[model samples]
Target: MRPDPQETAPAKKQRRYWHRTDWLSLFSGLLFIGIGVRYLVEPPPNTGVMVLTLVFGLGFAGFFAVVSRAFRKR
Candidate 1:
């Protein structure tokens, strides 16, 4: 017996939340890069701002890498 056409129509796949993680990470990285550039061009009185931007940029890059790896299908 065949199924009803309405029932058999492939269910639209639900989008995974993890799929957005990579894009979020990329955006975060870009934001940090902008801050880093600003600090590089106009050094802040406190060294912490520069350090923070470097950490933020690197951390986001690492996050993107890990998420990309996790989502990769063999």
Candidate 2:
């Protein structure tokens, strides 16, 4: 007798649940949104200052993410 096609096929892989959000990327996204709003309302006078702020803000977000991960329950 021939085996059933369904039985011969490999089992499908189930995806694991992702419970936590990526904090660093989340904060970075918010920062960009806020910056976009600010740009539309009142543009920054200096491009250099805006660039510096972005760099520092991302650094701070990264630090926060690391600290959060360190304290999170495994």
Candidate 3:
């Protein structure tokens, strides 16, 4: 005889630690903060410099994310 569907137990969801870290949001927030700080400076930074800094920040954030994921996997 077939078992009743309602009698079946629900599957438990697998939890992941990485889900807690919103990397995109973190990166965007940092970018906004940097732009705000740039405005606060007496002499506005050169556009090239600002772009370079943002690129560097992105690289750092990416590296951090990779390291975090690796550690979390352990």
Candidate 4:
């Protein structure tokens, strides 16, 4: 089929810059890892610290999972 000789197709859209967004993810991952490592090095004497350590460790694991998926898609 041949038609619409005078019609034009739409132009492609340009993606916005996102390099700065990478820093946020990096900082969050690092922060969680740091807290986890700190807890590993010095066992928390208090129950609150123990709970925080477990949460941050889980957070670090979750961060890696998300980052890996994002990188794979990219």
**Overall lDDT per candidate, in order of appearance:** 0.72, 0.89, 0.79, 0.68
lDDT of 3 by residue, 1-74 (tens): 99887689687788875546856469868887978887797588788988888888888888877887788789
TM-score of each: 0.41, 0.69, 0.59, 0.38
Candidate 2 runs further than 4 Å off: 1-18
Give the candidate number with the greatest TM-score. 2
- Model 4, position 31, has a per-residue lDDT of 66
Candidate 4 off by > 4 Å: 1-44
Off by over 4 Å in 1: 1-40, 43-45
Clashes of each: 0, 0, 0, 0
Task: State the lDDT of candidate 2 residue by residue for 18-43, as single tens digits.
Answer: 88978999999998898888899995
| 1-74: candidate 1 lDDT, tens digit per residue | 98899898989989876534456567676877787687689856477866776777677777877777777743
Ranking by lDDT: 2, 3, 1, 4
Compose the digit string of candidate 4's lDDT tens values, residues 1-74: 77675566566689897543454466567766876787699865687876786677667766876787788688
lDDT score of model 1? 0.72
Give the Å shift of residue 57 in candidate 2. Answer: 0.5
Please state the error at residue 5 of candidate 2 in Å: 23
